[model samples]
Target: MRESTTLLRSPSNLASSQRLLFNSKLILPSPVPFKPKHMPCKVFCSQTSESSSTQTLKLISTLRAIPDWADGIKERGMKKKKSLYNHEKWLQHRSSLRHVRHLLSSLSSRVILSLIPPVIFFTSVAAVVAAYNSAISMNWLPEFFPLLRASSLPYQLTAPALALLLVFRTEASFARFEEGRKAWMKVVSGAEEFARQVMANVDGSSNVALKKALLQYIMAFPVALKCHVIYGSDIRNDLKDLLKQDDLSIILSSKHHPRCMIEFISQSIRLLLLEESKRTALESKISCFHEGIGICEQLMGIPIPLSYTRLTSRFLVLWHLTLPIILWDDCNWIVVPATFISAASLFCIEEVGVLIEEPFPMLALDELCNLVHDSIQEAIAMEHLIHDQLLTKRKNHSNEHLTNGRPTS
Candidate 1:
């Protein structure tokens, strides 16, 4: 249900999410500008002969394999809840604590809301213990039960150990978070380089259609990778305008989505007319995409060791459960609120560490993928402009040579 309250519901969220929190909750991103998938096919048809009609027919036959539009809407509704905010927004209020309004909003945040249940359970335990002490002091009962009290010595000795456990737990999770971010950064930059190499090196004049389709494949890699890391992602809608029906179906059915996109890229590269060396150089760029994919898969498949995580959780819960007893001798009835504050603060830190253990959702992957798509599409439009200017200037030079029978200076 939290997915229902995603960024797409509010127009104002568009600016902040464009890059600030490129991390998205929805399987589908907010709408970006795009050309229809069939536009490139139509343009290529005008320039080529009848034999190309065979590829067009194949594309038409695959159209029936696509699911209905209504089915897509229902599937998107099923993705598990994505991380609501990245670490940046988590500490946004630390700088300005002068206003009471900021304090109220902080308390209402999803992070605090999640901690309420555990914090309440600990506080109630403290209240019951305090009541029992009150009854014994009033002589309402005999000294039959031992006092729920602990000395300061054991706590003093274990304090350093508890501090180290929490520090190590948080540090490890943050390292994974940083690694995921860097991995995505590599993927985004790699996609950009591949597109740049393709547009500049490949001569689109002879086979403009293949050139257009290859760029589509390059753009689809990051989107496919985004889906690969984030579970419950269906590429059919995300890639509708970038791939043909047949290619889309192949990727959707494949177990490894990003690998499928790379195969498409490699096949397109082979069909293009280019020097062997240039093709090799472009293939090298495609290889970098696979490296990024491997890093992402490693992060998702292998988490921080389970035993360490379990130890940390068990330690935090036990520490809070016994906290009131240690503080009762010094503060008596004040132990109830002390227990509340301790549980809320310590548990909040550990919860954050746990949330970021898997880094994709905390990273803004959808937004980065969108950036890859826009950059390639913009380059395609610019490439056509440059080609037209070069053609016009060449025609002028030809006319001068024919009229004067001499080369123009």
Candidate 2:
């Protein structure tokens, strides 16, 4: 029976059964490939992390470059702006032919009218000479009368000395003018410095009236000096609002208004500095005030020497008087314009010297005083504004602390 069953199962079936049993004994895997469900998620996470890290590095690099780029742009802009400002300022002082043209263009009708008197005088003198010459040439007047035709040698000899005299005169007057200007500048600087010191050093911000009064005095000092130097009697217009009636009256009634005002200013500063050691600075500034006044008074008292001035005037008169006669022989009608030109030049130079000698009205003291007044007014207003802002900030801070449940000392 066993032989018969073996014959029924072929050789192939026996071999497959043998292989299965062998594989089962060895633990063989399934035919389909093994893959995790989260394999794609892992790949995606790694890729995203790498990309994010690279992007973060790139962002950091860009942020680092940003400030450098901004700084470069700002530097370039500043340089360009500075260069542009310099170029504009350079344009003002350029030495071009326009300067001469400007002078010519500025000649006005008033200038021409002012010169007419000299022109008329020379023209009349020349006309007279021409008429006399014509009479002599036509034999209407006797030639034997010997028309006093003087040589130009005498006039030429006097010219050098006369020129020197005029130059010295003008120089002396210009020196006085320069001194006066410097003195006024000293006054301005001293007053400004004193005000600044008082504003900075003195703890008088609490007393608004006192601070305003000090600033008022600073402003009034220059105005008073201007008034005194220019011989202006009425300062009520300038000081009506700046000062109390009593102070204004004191300044007005005093013979030396500037000195009196300075004394009052000093007294006020002394009172303000009673507890401080900064009064020395005030004294130094007061000394500067005295120096300015002394300089102005010195200029006013000491004038150009009378002898030199008289000599120059005489020389100019004689020169003009003889210039026409000297040129009448050769120039005839032309001498008139020539003499007018010469006389106008000399007289204008002399007049300029005379005008600048005083250095008050001509230098425009009123305008200068107004400028100083405005500056002090503006400075005081600004300081007061700043003080008010500080007080407001302190109050705000204290209120903030109180609101935060803290006590402020």
Candidate 3:
């Protein structure tokens, strides 16, 4: 009876130990320990001890079979998860800007079209009516209607002069628009050329770190210009990919984005001067970048002055007021068309001039920032490609040296 009781107690103890070990296995990071309690046995006291030892050995062997027992799989998984999160953050950062749709929608074409017809119609009617009235008052008509007739020559001359002045003013405004566009193109071209020089011949090496630093200045310039013209302030985190943490922090330190970028470029150029033995080439590149910034600044800072604006506006208003009165007497049916045409011509001229005056502001109808951003991105991508190629070539050369039984320098 005593032996049976002991035997029953022994089996129950082993079962409890095995259950504990199995539960612990779920939380353990590595190889599970082998033990006699995890296995069933029908051996005597001395044999039971041996069987227990054997079961421990078997458990150890099974634990060794489990993959990831020795390797840091959990650490690697955490790292991978972290990398994915960073990638997502980077994508979001790059995509924060407003799109081209806003620019397209804000264009001045509709506004100009709407204002042109009224201007032309009114002006034409005024001219015709003024001529008829002058002819009657001056008695220059045929003798049969001498009482009502007058000289029409003064009216004829006055109408032509006013029409000529309006046309000339319109042409002048358009000329300014054309000039502004040319200047913007100049800025874009200069920026591209400067970036190319920096990437290609500046260091004669594929240094991604240095290239990114330089590209930041190039990328930031236009954005700064746009911000300056539109908001009169340079806000933070405008271009995440181009700007580094340090650059942003420094820029935000001051209130001006354009000036901040200019200072950064200036400092970068100074550093390049110190590092580069060739002084002249660095100076030329720096000069070009400055010139581009200056051109954009010129456009943004000096709009067609308010005085000119006021004069043009006043003249247009005065002309419109007199137009109806002059045309009311003659060509009453045609007055509407004449007034509309004259008004449209004047309004279109003014609207176009205003649109082009500040080219960097990016109106609904103006050039999109995507064009500038894409250009910078392409330059950066090309630089990266070149850097990768250089690295690969270096690796290949090292491998070749090893295969040829030569020491790599």
Candidate 4:
């Protein structure tokens, strides 16, 4: 067997080769094929060099379609191309009345739909009871029925209890939701402040890579924190392009990706800080990240007590079931829509609390992450630009010194 050794030596080889060699596996024994010992002994190629070249070109073109920043991050931001209009912009476009109309038209039907299930359940019970009562009144069923004669005392007593239970449930959940929001706000605020400090205080003129790494880690913190709170570990797709392979691998392997990112950031910051004690202010800001993550973890782990939740649910079901009994006698077949409106309102409140309690996905976390990312990118870019300008100035100064026959530092 004649073994052919060919090295596709280029920066674009990994991407093009992966696409070209995916379906085909060729086995040819080579003692040492590439620099990596793990490299496959078999080399697979597309039919011809021309096909590989064509596929490579196509891949490059496809890659070019993606807008990646110089720091290897793609700005994942609002996809909508339409410009957002504030009240001022709206006034310029149309009259104040029209602007007011547009503002008022922002109601979401999806929110209404979300509250329908519980409303429908309660309404069905009301309808069924109302229908039964009508049948009894019209001689379809005996008026002396045991259930019909059953006292409404129990239902009356428990109604207030159920109301109180739901109120407490909603209030508690909303508190957690509010706390989660505040915690995340700290994360965003800390990330921005930290990025600004690192860019402004840390001298990047001597080492741009260190400054860039610090900013990248700061941006990655919130994203990692989000994934952690949500119990998701698939951060490679989010941070893969933003960081080097080693840093990315460490993040993937760590149990807490956010903490890992923080450690990396702290290490980078420490290296930049000549006197550790002098960086106490920046260190405190970094600590805010840990505090935010801790708060989120508390919210995620410690929910409203399960027994309390179960009791509330049971009370709600029982109360709604008997509500039709009391209302049937008074309303006489006009209870369905009434029950629907009441139940819809109550259930909507409950659902809203539950949805916002975790507050990870609902709080526009992606938008916040993107915002932090953009700010960090801007800060780093500014630092790099300034560093480049300083370098150019120093070079010109050195050249002048040489021309004038003076010793240059």
Candidate 5:
């Protein structure tokens, strides 16, 4: 009774959910179809009809038609670079000066742009202080400028503290980045494994529609999750071709699309014409999806402690603000360029820290989602070919036995 009611829910993501990480189902079994001649597969077996062939071809084309997330999706953040995983290629990228376009369009530019205001402010302070010292010495003007500098003793004493703050801030953000990567890896692997199980276990003509729909949900899960973790993403556009209109509406209308997709998977497993033990085994794979959602939420909902971030920022400003005074005794006017170099270099580290803190933007979620979709489709496309190859081997084995007048046991 409860399982039947799941379909009637207006949106699978209930209007209210108290299970917050942040700030932020069963179906009836269908009747088993009777066995028929030429059952090539115990699971997903069909009569090899023209309609089935056409359906298979249609599925392949539909998968191919879905656009890749790696191309032209820069608004969501992150561009795909093949060399990120290739050490040799990355070295070449680093050594080559020809990638002027890369320098202009990369996340590097965004970080530099963000640093502009602070870098200018601190460098100007250095310039003004240097000029004031000159003006007072030459009697050209009175000391009207603000006293922006302090003794260098504080910078010397707190230098270790600043180092520690920067180190901790960057380390914490990178850890979150690594955590997100691993969580999605689980999701990808889970999707692949679950699809393989469905393709190999769920059998017959009666459940053909169910089998196809189940694969569609498996493919849709990662895309839903990709949208869920990142801001400004619409799941409908991504899933429109992959899922049926009704199912897509139900999932997209839900408050949490990724969780809604998981519910769809659970209900599909329940509806499978499988024994209790088999269904339970299949249902267990949903944990991977859950784990991914939880980890992504944890990273998105909770950031590195605010105290750490604020402390680092304030320390940098104060240190650079007073930096010229400390060097005024020796470096004098040279403090202008020195202050610029220090501010630009140090602030860049913090900017990069902030960039990767959210994790999702830095991640290639689009490509990862597309990989899951492509893998499931690729496996299914090869199914009949694998079966036919096995059939040919079996035929040859039987003929050899007949010729030798023995089974060769």
Candidate 6:
């Protein structure tokens, strides 16, 4: 798998990099340094032996050959791909670190400040309690109320109720995550089926080039979607391979790349369905793509509401505070253990729920963008193989026509 790199450079720098075009490919270095006044660039250039001059000519001619309609498509596709690639890259890059050091560092000063008062108060209370206990033992008053004690009836009931609520909420959040995964699977399956139908039923002889381009689009759309949802943009060369030059031009000119790509995919599907014989079947498959997009959008747009989150957090905090008080009366020594267990349980539930609520975002545990990229590449490769076969068949047909003295139009 090719690793993505982010480049931070000025427009002049970007122009310079584009001109370099070494070996008909760009070599992206790992941990590419970000210069002032530029964004980081993803590194995953091709490795070819062609000289920079040849690469420039090739790029120019390729751009010129792209249809006008394809003008902005490549840029849009690339933006979508890069966003997903970056997110997945970040997730993968951060997986080894058990803790987020940067986040911890930011909190260090505040944590120290918060600890002082609690430390002083607790120490003073302990000293006074010890003195009072000694006096009472020496027959000063009567007896000392045990500082640590177990819970009574109210706490027993409250603990079980809170536990059940936490468990239910966590399970519900997990169910949403599972649904999001299933939806993506449906997208992949539907896209594959639609591509197969087009390849099998469409007339290969009429506009073979256009048909091949459409097939590439079919392969690229889902990959673009995966990138869009996960990383917020596309940063892969795979997009450049699939998008037409005209479309690429338009995407570069536009601001909303993902939405544009979605529009392009919808338009392509519409055009494919305009064919006489396969119209109905193609329409059905297009509907599947639409449905899949809707499902993913639902997952992305509707998260566990903030109201519920606030309520849960408030309840947990209040529950914890009262917990020590309740237990201090009966289970003095055991209060420590009980408090620790309760806090751990509440924190775990909150953490798990938060992770599942946004299934599209790449996490340390996410199925990285590389998975989607690989699947898309597989689809494109299959399309390429089919195109090659079709070309071979055409060549053989032409040969047979010439041998039989027929005109080869």
lDDT of candidate 1 at residue 401, scale 0 to 100: 77
lDDT on C-alpha atoms for all candidate structures: 0.81, 0.73, 0.60, 0.72, 0.80, 0.60
* Candidate 1 per-residue C-alpha lDDT over 1-409 given as tens digits, one digit per residue, 9 for 90 to 100: 6666875667777776675655454555767556776788877887575656867877775653333332343234224344335577666645475477657777545556667667878899999888888787787878886787888788889879888988898999999999988988888888888898998999978868888889889899999988888876667888997789998999888988899889999998999999999989988998788899989999999998999989988887888788888888899999999999988888888877877888787666777887788887887788789889999999998997798996668
Question: Model 5 over residues 1-409: C-alpha lDDT tens digits?
Answer: 7765775453643443322322341244556776743365633444456669999998986654423222224333343321124687667667766487666675545566566667778899999899988777676776674433456787778889887888888888899889988998899999999999888888846688888988999999999988888777777898998998999989868999989998988988888898788788789988888988999898999998898889889889888988999888778799999999999989889977887898887877787888888889899989978888999999999998798996566
Candidate 2 regions off by >4 Å? 1-119, 205-208, 388-409
Error of 2 at 377 (Å): 2.7
Instruction: Name the lDDT of candidate 5.
Output: 0.80
Q: What is candidate 3's lDDT per residue for 1-409, written digit by digit as tens?
A: 9987787579787799788999999778975677655554434666878989999999987755433232333223222211222577677656745355434654333443344344544566566565665676677786565322234454556667565655655565566656555665666676676677676655635454665687678766766655555543335656565688877787777776666777787667666633454445655655554665566567667766677667667776766656655555564446556666667766666655654454443332113344566786787688779889999999999998888996558
lDDT of 4 by residue, 1-409 (tens): 1222234555477668786676444444446656565433323333466688999999987665432221122112111122334698866778758767655653433344455456666898888878777777778876686444346678777778777877888888888878988998899998999888776666656647887888888888998887676544367887776788999999989887888898998888777744565466667778889899889888888988888888876766776777777776566666687777677766666666565555565566767788889988877677678889999999999998888896558
True-vs-predicted CA distance for residue 394, candidate 4, Å? 11
Q: What is the lDDT of residue 235 in candidate 5?
A: 79
lDDT of 4 at 144: 80
TM-score of each: 0.73, 0.67, 0.53, 0.64, 0.73, 0.54
What shift in Å separates residue 21 of candidate 1 from its native position after superposition? 99
| Candidate 2 structure quality by residue, lDDT tens digits, 121-141 | 656676676677667767888
Find the candidate with the highest lDDT and give its number: 1
Give the residue spans of candidate 3 off by over 4 A: 1-109, 112-155, 201-210, 232-234, 272-279, 301-311, 333-337, 361-369, 383-409
**Model 5, stretches more than 4 Å misplaced?**
1-108, 142-151, 399-409
Candidate 6 achieves a global lDDT of 0.60
Comparison by TM-score, 2 against 5, better one? 5
List the candidate 4 regions with Cα displacement exceeding 4 Å.
Answer: 1-111, 142-144, 147-161, 231-234, 270-273, 278-282, 384-409
Better of 2 and 6 by TM-score: 2
Model 2 Cα shift for residue 42 (angstroms) = 99
